[model samples]
Target: MSVNEIDEQGLGPQARRSEATKRALLDAALADMEATGEASIRITKILQESGVTNGSLYHHFGSREGLVQAAIAERFLGSVTKGLAVFAHRVGEVGSTEQLFEVFRDELVRIGSPDVQTQRIHRMTALAAALPRADLLERIIADQGRYFDGAADSLARLQEHGFIRFDVDVRAFAAWFLGLSLSRLLSDIDPQLNPDNEWSEYTFRALVAILTPAPSAH
Candidate 1:
């Protein structure tokens, strides 16, 4: 009867079908929102587009609002996770701080510009503001910490290579940069904001400017 109930039954053919239906519905919702810039979407439209039945929709997502929130979460976090994975792979291969940041900046620009992602960021901001449960807040904080850990590794590598000033605090720098980037993503995601004037480029340049490098011997 409930989404959780469906999930609890384990992965059977029907379960997989249900999961796929949910994915399709969410994908449809995102595509529709991006095309029309509409904030409110109907579950019936999503079901119709996804080619899923009403019962399947109900089994997959508790309600339209919950589906919207889940879709938002999936798109935003999925992009972020993909970007971080790329950065991690690059760093692991070359062990170069410069290379890591290069990949990171490019990925951020791509992720931050998309309409679906921007919408998700806006949703996340609203959810965080209104949600008062301590456990929910704790999970949000923990998720943030995990995300920061990936960036912190690259900063630490920069410090190790003497690309950054020794006095610089890696965790603090990572936190500050991450916060700034996420804020930018939130702003760009808002449908009302017209941020088409090289915002990401400027942000990347600012980051490179502030990251003080050590003096090299002549």
Candidate 2:
């Protein structure tokens, strides 16, 4: 199920090579999605761009939808996990709740922006899966669940250590954070959703405020 599992099961070498090929295919698909924010992406172009063999593609992912799901899961999960790790680390490093939240706000904005067309399209496709393939949508949600649980674990640790406020619900916050991100994904389709590029900043600040302890009066 995981990379480690693949290694432990005696499929390490082949899995490692296949993983590289998978990354190439994902990167190629991203390039296509970035170029055009279309959900119905062309499979031939991705194969050509990645130079992945037809047999290999079919072997690794059985269907066009499967390939799309794998690529989206890998890319989106990587970013979510990476950003959450840093945010949690920063939480432990900072003393005050304000300082900790500043770190979170910065991470939120940074991760959400610099507007890469590829990422927007990738997100649209993932969200689009909800309509045509409920099964695929479930897979994407499950993929995110693993990373969100990891982040919630870190938050629980911080709360236990008194780095974060004890009253805050870590898992709920993670769900809310992800829900906000998905809602923001629609902003690309209709800028009306974002309103002024302030959604990330505003939401980050609001959520952190709720999670922080009430300041002690002098």
Q: Estimate the overall C-alpha local distance difference test score of candidate 2.
A: 0.68
Which RMSD does model 2 reach against the true structure? 5.0
lDDT per residue (tens digit) for residues 9-114 in model 1:
5665676776688789889877765554436577778878899888777677777766665665555456556656766666555445476567657656555656
Residue range 115-205, candidate 2, lDDT tens digits: 5334444555656654466776677678678867877886787677666778878888788776666566556467556623576667776
User: Which residue pairs overlap in candidate 1's backbone?
Assistant: 118-189
Which runs of model 2 end up more than 4 angstroms from their true locations? 1-16, 37-40, 115-121, 185-201, 214-218
* lDDT minimum window of 10 residues, candidate 1: 121-130
The residue ranges of model 1 lying beyond 4 angstroms of the native Cα positions read: 1-12, 36-38, 93-144, 182-205, 213-218
Q: Distance from true position, residue 30, model 1, in Å? A: 1.6
CA lDDT of each candidate? 0.64, 0.68
Q: What TM-score goes with each of the models?
A: 0.62, 0.72
Quote the positional error of residue 32 for candidate 2 in Å.
2.5
